[model samples]
Target chain A: MAGVRAAVVGTGLIGGSLLLRLRDAGLDVTGWDPDPVARGHVRRWGVACPDAVEAAVTGRDAVFLCGPLPTLSGMLARVAAATPEHCVLTDVGSTKAEVAATATASGLGHRFVPGHPMAGADRAGPAAADPGLLVGAAWVLCPGPNGLASFRRLAALLIEVFEARVVPMSAPEHDAAAALSSHVPHLLAGALAGAVQRSTLRDAVLSLAAGSFTDGTRVAGGPPQRTANMLLGNRDRVLSGLASVRAMLDELADALRAADAGTLTDRLAEGRAARATLGERRFDTHQREFPAPADHAGELDYLRALGAAGGHLTGCRTAGGAVTYTGQLPHTPDPA
Target chain B: MAGVRAAVVGTGLIGGSLLLRLRDAGLDVTGWDPDPVARGHVRRWGVACPDAVEAAVTGRDAVFLCGPLPTLSGMLARVAAATPEHCVLTDVGSTKAEVAATATASGLGHRFVPGHPMAGADRAGPAAADPGLLVGAAWVLCPGPNGLASFRRLAALLIEVFEARVVPMSAPEHDAAAALSSHVPHLLAGALAGAVQRSTLRDAVLSLAAGSFTDGTRVAGGPPQRTANMLLGNRDRVLSGLASVRAMLDELADALRAADAGTLTDRLAEGRAARATLGERRFDTHQREFPAPADHAGELDYLRALGAAGGHLTGCRTAGGAVTYTGQLPHTPDPA
Candidate 1:
């Protein structure tokens, strides 16, 4: 990819990582963040910090929006107002349909390309910035009619810099897929974790809990507004995804209630197979995984106490999932 | 915890990991594994190798039978033949109610204790064993009679050695919990992973899949017969759990069908909270969660090729509730 000047909005996990990656590849990049904390975060990552989004995107060849759903439109409006006419815009939000719709309705459609880079970690902020964050990961690009072939070219360029795979789809397909791949599962995990309380022996529950619980609930720890926007934003597609999930679940429930052993086995078998295939490609950490300093018994204890207070359970000893301990904490449980 | 003499039967992941833990704490321990491969695996972990199950538990004070359900009765028969009058035989099977029934039917009721250790990896066998495997994990002890006091003492010893917590529940309750905690989730994951073929954009789906897909399906990668036993042994409870899951899915589907943002948001919110709690606890892993091994890729490839050849999806990649890619090499996709 030729040298690309990019402006990263949000300056947190995705954006910060992108900035690092862009610079690591010798690309000239600047960052924009409204929050001092976030700006500081990007500054720490050695990216050129600009005072405002308008200033940042006006001169950059491409503007990358990388914050939660709510912040995207506001920032886009700023970009629309001052961005050079030739500038291309994209985002790394979880949902695309809604974000795309909002952009069109806001009349910033021409300059914006509806896109989502599918890569990140549970912990957010520039401190967690990884140049390889999107390495070999999928970057979903949903281009509007006015998004332009040049925008498409920009998407491919972003893919190379991030070392990511680009999958093209409509805003709605992206929405349903995200719901299928991310949203509904997160919801299921949140509800499952939430239903557990002091009365449920949650500590004991978590101790015995395995990867299934964590995977089912990974999205629960995300920013509520961000997750809500994804849900409320792509309402139709998400709902559609949920409906398919519901049909699958209802059939399972009936089979169980009726004591249909064959059907029950079949269902369990089905889930087993789903998880198996999905987990089929495990990455070799050619590099070490947890850079987490030696185990902190005290911090672990503190987190445990907090969880207990919420009728939630926590663990700090084994490192399987949730390698990071920070963030909003998981609130939702998908019963399935 | 007082010093204890323990014999772990069917020494695989749980049994071997347990035995190593026992010996590390200076307890007298021995292992009995009829499977030569399993025996070698257990012996490598520093556990005493007993000639047979009867020999292992005969003079030993406590014995833990940790294998699939089909072998439980045979194991019990061996225990009955050579058990000391006060010996307590416990199990580490996923399901408890039926296993307890098996003990009763086998005429070893009082001397038999039904157990399900909540702590374990989706991976199995001694190759998967580690001394700290059960540390900070939970063990469910469902004792049957007074002779169980001795075993309870041994269990307490285990609790201290492994640094794990304990939960008390009847066999049926244990099964019900396992159904919720383990079985149903496995089934659901299998079904979900089953829908997506490995060869279908393998690079893109996997590169973008992230933690959720991997974690959700972790259980599906378990041993097939072991998985079969979990489903059948706790068939009733598992069936009920499936019903509940199906019900939840149905509700989600309904909301989607009606395009009810309000209800969908509410449901999503509930799920979010549940997942957050689980995420907070960090679920099963307290140490390292290796991304799914590359072997999963092979399984996917294999299934992809198999599906191509047979015009159907293959369930080889999944088991338990997680996916596995370790054991076999996948065939190329094109079949002549």
Candidate 2:
């Protein structure tokens, strides 16, 4: 679609990345941004910079409006004023109900399609944008039956350029899913961090926060406005998601309070398997597991046998005398 | 002190890391691990491998037991059998109450220091062990008043190599703090994953799981055996931690269910500021952010203004025309 003309509004990470990818794919892409710095940055990122909206939107086949949810409607109103009746309008926003409602109220219902790129970074602004950032990511397209063809076509183009898979669903379903998957999780991470910061050891523990804590709260620290809009705009679903998470905490509390090693073991086992499944996603694609050497297996077996025999061992060290894995004492441990 | 012999009782990550650091500081250090593979790996990782516990412990002036909770007491018993009368013993575990109890009950309390290394990884075994992993970490040293001097000496040695801050506290306090900081969070992550797995979009949504979801649930998917032992080992503390977390979640739910945007924003903002404090740790002293062209910032700002203007913007073919950020047209977003 080198001949395809596309205009991207917002020019932030999601929209900016999409525009950059389109230009790289050799499509005719014009970026329109009121912020001179944003415009200059897009041009530097290699997208064609347009001087005016008419030069960018009038004849283009498609346009993507991706910005703060609060700014979308106002931008969409401008898009309506300049674009022709056939120009396809699409958005990359986390929430659907409000955007869709506002559009319907404004009578731009016929030519718009709602889409959300399920991928984002903790960083924002144009500098954080990457041409291929959305590649291999999932993009959900919410379109009515009448608008499916055009939306699918746009999604297909996205797939070719960004390597993103398109999952089509109803708007409410998309909102609900996002509310649970993204909005509520961010809120929870933030809340967790907040609670921990209240502890006396906040400085001590937070300093030692490893990959788990970092990753757990990564989104919590990212673009505040985006998260807020997603939560309040999708209030119903987000609240329900919060409820779901609370229920989970309740179950875990019950299990831990019960102090049944069996149950704890079972839960941990389940979580272990689930994380393995999750690791298949892009983030942990390069995860490495360093299992103990095969030779260690033999040593373990031999030690077990030694214990079984009349021979009791005090402790056995490895060859270099620095590594240790077990403690075999002559006496049995007391039941705690 | 430099001439003293030291025995490291379990060749796991913490144990192995400590042994290497001690010996590198000029102390005579020997390791005791029965699992041959771990022994080999730890040796390869630069730990001194000892062949027998009695040989390793007989003359050692200091010993650190680093292993699973179930094995701590048993190891202490063996140390009692062969260790010199002045040998000071310690442990590296997540929770401390159990270790303190075991050490006291095993008849080795007077000679042992029940301690815990607050640093570790999601992965375990000798290979996953890093020699400098505990460098700059927090090592909680909990001991009865009688063993304070020996324990502080041990901690002082760690400070030279690992640069870890030695925080002194009672075993119960250490365990309670750990429950709040670590165990409860792990349980929450696992439970969140479990909840999603049980939701209506279990297959669809999880299949579309991205970095955020993977991150949010990372703690849930840690080692099964370790998690189980850690959670149930200090059952009361973990349960109390669960209560604390539950209360926080409930507060969030109420705020959301009530459509209190102000409360949500406050929570999100607080989390954002607190998470920012993470940068204070300076753990990644060796790494830096990838540099980008300096001019990109100015250009990005320009684009924001264009998107904000109410205008019809489409594609590159309409070059010279700019699409602005504006509140003019209605984008017909697909309804749910």
Candidate 3:
């Protein structure tokens, strides 16, 4: 670990943050970005900013290609040609099968380990680089043939240095799973948001938008070209994912059209149960108990007062003539 | 608003919350719920808990039918039967067209004002009643013939007492808009979540689930019956929305299958722009300026440390081998 030298090509958010993460972990890291401004910022971080990509990777122990997916293969070839024979080459591309294929054809497969970290921010570029960006995020590893040792080493580095959760899978498996877990969701959000954007009553709909709309559409705000590149790179898997989604929507539509309460209820219940397990954690909630009221109107008053005071009833029970109500307080502090 | 006597039927989250909202606004409210536990909560709140639905509406200035959509017409009929001649009747049903039609057929159209509050909580029942739930939420009002006067009165109550945004639209318009805004998004969430639930790799997929997945699935976790009721009540509009959604998804799928980068990028960009307008207001971020660094690696290190220390770079410049970075500081306090 002490003598590890890493070079990051492309200083966008992922590349930039990765360079900093390596440096902060006490590794000798050099970075290169085509943009002068991005390159300059990387230099200011106390890490070397080589004048050329070749100079940056010449003697590196590990070389990371974090360029746009479309240009990854070229960058990988160039970086591989410049680096030492033992220097392991890897990438942070969202897609993998193509990269694996390219590396195999180029005879660099043995030295290549494909990886895709499940993390990002709304912002982009080297300036947005943050070592903690990858913290607690899932980093999927898809090692190519004869690259197991390198994959293990890189996996160790990601976990120990970046504090990422390492998930191992084949390149095809990664692509398939990502299609379901990430790619299709983004496409759906984009589609839904796009549909709304084209509507004549867009403003009216937006005015009535709530947390549900905002949350569902959040990922649709990603950079256009970048999103499109990911979708195209994993075209086959994405198409498959889209098929599954279409089938699900069709079933829902059928149930709705038929007014099949039983089917609708079953689907909704299943969804509720599934979503409940996704996060596995939530912020601690504040709770309070209030005394019972004299009648329905009184109970309403108590609830309103609590709500006005930024609380919500979680539970309530009556004993004798009095009732006790428990509720969760608002997360945000009351306005001063 | 003083001396206005109101009666509420059904004591689920919405009904219970509404009763509380009115009573807290200094109105005398009586309530009745078939569920003994729900009725018990109303009684404990200090508001009159009438044993019979008729007793609750007998002398009220306004009667709110807050029961399920299927039972709404029945409750409206009963309330209308017992209500005084001048009593105004309103409802908090999610769908307006059906309810409006029912009221018209019942010969109580003039006295009925169909309203739907775009608000809710994850939980349900009287125990989950929240007064501030409607605060700042859009409350769509579809006033009937003589219901205009009462609609105005109720709108004022909603605005002044509950701090809700009153939006007026025809019953048909309300249904159409709601189908797009709430009902369909909800169904989409349920469908997506359900798809994941039925997957063999549900656990793995859920484990890798990110903010996009969680946000898109949030509404799917709502009570199944409640969700089904809303969807069914707005069946025709919901079906239209579903058709639109399906068409959008199909277009996206076609683009993916054809590997049309241009089309995909255009759609993604369109979605991003539209989503940008959904939340009109956002917190003003804070920016900070820091001196530049001598090398790219150093700058990266600096940026990461700043991010770790809760900050973000907004801009950077280099002069004479040195660089300066401008960034936004983190909004929250650093953890000890």
Report the number of the highest-lDDT candidate.
Answer: 3
Docking class of 2: incorrect
Candidate numbers sorted by TM-score from highest down = 3, 2, 1
Kindly provide the TM-score of model 2 when superposed on the true structure, using C-alpha atoms.
0.74
Better of 1 and 3 by lDDT: 3
Q: Candidate 3 chain B: worst 10 consecutive residues by lDDT?
A: B307-316
Question: Mind sharing the TM-score for model 1?
Answer: 0.71
* Full ranking by DockQ: 3, 2, 1
**What's the count of clashing pairs in each model shown?**
80, 71, 35
TM-score of each: 0.71, 0.74, 0.77
lDDT of 3 by residue, A65-140 (tens): 9999999999898999999888888899888889998898999876888888888765678878898888777677
DockQ, each predicted model: 0.14, 0.20, 0.26
Tens-place lDDT per residue, model 1, A1-336, is 446787888877788888888888887888888888888777777777877667677777888888777677777787777777777888888877667888889876767877777666766777777887877665666655555443445645765566554455566656656666666665555445444321243433443455555555566566544555566666665565555655665655566566565675666565555445445433321111222342334333432332222111111122443133221122334599
lDDT of 2 by residue, B1-336 (tens): 488788888887677777777777788888878787777875775656767777767878888888788887787788778877777888887777777877777666667876766666767776666667877665666656455445435655666556665555567766766776677667767777777766765544564467778788887766777877888788887776566555656666677777776776776776677687775433211111111221223323332222222111111111123211111121324598
Choose 2 or 3, whichever is better by DockQ.
3
Residue-level lDDT tens digits of model 1 in B181-231 = 677666655544543322232233333456655665566666645665667
lDDT of 3 by residue, B191-248 (tens): 7888877776565566456666777888888899999999999999889876776677
